[model samples]
Target chain A: MECTDFKLIVVGGSAGSFSVVSHLLAGLRPDFKLPIVLSLHRLKHVRSGLVEGLSLKSKLRVIEPNDKEKLQQNTVYLAPANYHLFVELDGTVALSTEESHNHSRPSIDHTLGSAAYAYRDKLLGILLTGANRDGAAGMKEIADNKGFTIVQDPLSCDIDTMPKEALKLFRPDRLMNPEDILHFLNALPG
Target chain B: MQNSEKDYNYKEYLLILKECSPYDFSEYSDNSIDRRIKKIMRDQGLNMEELVLKTRTEPDFVEQVVEAITVNTTELFRDPDVWNHILKKVLPALKHQKKINIWHAGCSTGQEVYSLLILLDHLQILDRAEIYATDISKKALEQAKKGQYFYNFNAEKYRENFKASFEGETVPDFDSYFSADADKDLLKIRTDFSEKVQFIKHDLVKGDLPFYNKFDLIFCRNVLIYFQGSLQSKIVERFHENLFPGGTMILGSHESLGGFFKTKFSKNGPVYHRTNSFHFKY
Candidate 1:
């Protein structure tokens, strides 16, 4: 799929995501204009300071979004702990706990599926190192919507189950290592 | 009236609520609604019988009941762990952004907004950020704009929350957070931070969004539960439209968007993002 109009980039992971995200952000330029949404499965009971921890490594603006909060370009949005985050049709960020899917409040499928529905052909869904099959159907949904889909090369993934599962469900447009993924992302016209 | 009569009357009272209030308590979890009504009745010094009878006749009584039913109990930094998380995980990511816009919905009495301002100040990024605090209640917005609170009310709680969430060794003095008059109207924020936040009266239910400015972060905690499913979805969709491509959205600890919108975000913890639609698989 051509990613010409794809402005939103969703990255989903769970176990061993910190290193992967760091690598991805480190590879991108500081002035990268695309919006990046990170959905990391976290313990519902613990305080997840993923945004603050990741902020130290990247030059982009990182934040925990609020209700009715508008989305901006070139920022990193971290899902708050114990809440499911969704993108509103208007392209703003919304948080909810209305219910749990995949037994996770901030389910990767929920986020990826929503974006696929909202952005259609312009969406790019990425599933990286993760433990569960949370993102399998979501990757398919992105493809079904004619949006671009990418999975971390399972051989290189810390936990290969998620990317492997996604690959089984659908053939993604790109399957590359972290370094190559960066080159691929940088090559995209914003 | 018999006990059964009282039960029927209670159901009728709830029906009246459905007719008058925007929220339909009929479909709300029964135990929760019962608990709220019981608390309202007890607080108003009225037994169930009296409450039912009085509510039927008093025109303004429904408004009181509406107020009692709505969830208005919010404190500054209501959840310190979340604040701690933001401090440790979120703010440092945006150090390079030239300007930041933060929307604080349900910013009742401005405590949360001040708490945020303090957080930004501590990070030394207060000058680069703009805060928009909006709420449906005019009275709450006015109080937030005033930026004052009573010392004896919940001052201790605020201080404790702040201390617990703060990352620095020398916690900023609470006095620095606010100023006070002889009458005890403790203005919780300095003018600079206060000025940075633009206060507007917005009804998330009916009216249009106030500003056209796209925000970097939006904090809408504990506001959508009051709305019905459709309204909640509509508002969430509106929020999506208001944001720039990579902005963040934060919700209350207990809230989620399961029934409302699609999730295109990478979950960090409490915050979500509208992934830049520009990044497609090459």
Candidate 2:
């Protein structure tokens, strides 16, 4: 699918993804129109205002979505700390406390797989630096759904296990450092 | 190429499940169920066909599959602020009643049940409350009934949640609730709390709501997210019918009412109250 045809942009990471996410957000045009979801792993059983913390650095409007909240353009949705976030067929958010996948809640695999199923080929999935293999299977799901996939270059990742796993599992459309990812986000059709 | 084949196998597995049993997975969203089946396959070291054969022949295999699919992890006072809100705002409104009936519909492992008991104990009304804690997983229900959990249960985080839940109030000694087991890494809930809770095995998706008496409060948290929108709405309607007029229903922090029931829920505590007279569907 063309970049303009994409309905949503999803990014998944764990451990060391904050810097890249913040940088990507900082580089986005204020008028960016595609909805973006951040499925970064977080400490469960503790209330952390990750969305609020990241909003300080992001130019785009960022919020933790309520269950069944509709998708909107030019906004960032952070998966809540303890729940698994899913994109529903109706383009709304659904959160589950179902058994954690890969030993992590807010699991990257759940988020990416559900988004792939929801948006089909009109989705772009980006996997970033992390120490676990959570996103590998989800990346494959996105590829299977004919969506575009990108991975942070393992050579440049601070913790390369996550991206390396994604790369090993399937071929992503792009493998670039944080700098190129930021540039790519800025260059997308608004 | 390989991933698409896996997807096909997942569908076949779901079909086999439906054909062999009274349950229907056709209404569920495929991705979540797909991942769960994959995990089952990996953990059992069996491909889809072998798994299907086991289910067809084995008497208890289907329950195990359902358990794996629906099981959710929970701990005491998770999202403590919400529990605190229930204590301060929700409980007081029902104070006029001489006895209170509470239902924790998806009470996996009974953390919430014990938490509620603790709160009631603090309020000195523990004797008057009867809680029915239910889950689809018999294994989880067995654990909840035992009231024993790993000693590794994050005391620091529990303390933090307690402080946040109580805000300015003096927090109870969180550790005092559980008696340490002789084994290094286990703790059992004090008998006082465990005695008041009743854990039952029940399925929310395909099974019927078996309660004869309407409840004063119902908690169905973090459970509906696995179902499709249609199933979620259907279950919420059933909950609405099962509740006494003005009885409160608490969903997970992230959960909300979908379909026509959207306007039925009032928003102060994000707790839905049934306003109309109740009627049983059957």
TM-score of each: 0.49, 0.87
Summing lDDT over every window of 10 consecutive residues in candidate 1 chain B, give the lowest-scoring window. Answer: B23-32
Residue-by-residue lDDT tens digits, candidate 2, B130-149? 88888877888888988888
> DockQ of candidate 2?
0.62
Off by over 4 Å in 2: A1-4, A43-46, A67-70, A88-92, A116-121, A140-146, A153-161, A164-172, B1-24, B206-209, B276-282
Which candidate gets the maximum DockQ versus the true structure? 2
Question: DockQ (Cα-based) per candidate?
Answer: 0.02, 0.62
Which CAPRI quality tier does the interface of model 1 achieve?
incorrect
For model 1, what is the error of residue A64's alpha carbon versus the real structure, in angstroms, after optimal superposition?
Answer: 21
**Which tens-of-lDDT digit does each residue in B1-282 have in candidate 1?**
353474566677788766655535554433234546877888888987788777777768876775566555466786887787787777887777998888887776777788888888888988898778887555677777777677675666677788988755467787886775535645456777677788987656654776865877888887775554566666677677677787778877656775324455555776777665544331
Summarize candidate 1's per-residue lDDT along A1-190 as a digit string, tens digits: 3646777888899888779898788768888888988888875434556777888788788887765466788898887765667765678665654345676768888788877866788787788988888878888998998989889998888889889889888899989888888887788886
Q: State each model's CA lDDT, in order.
A: 0.74, 0.82
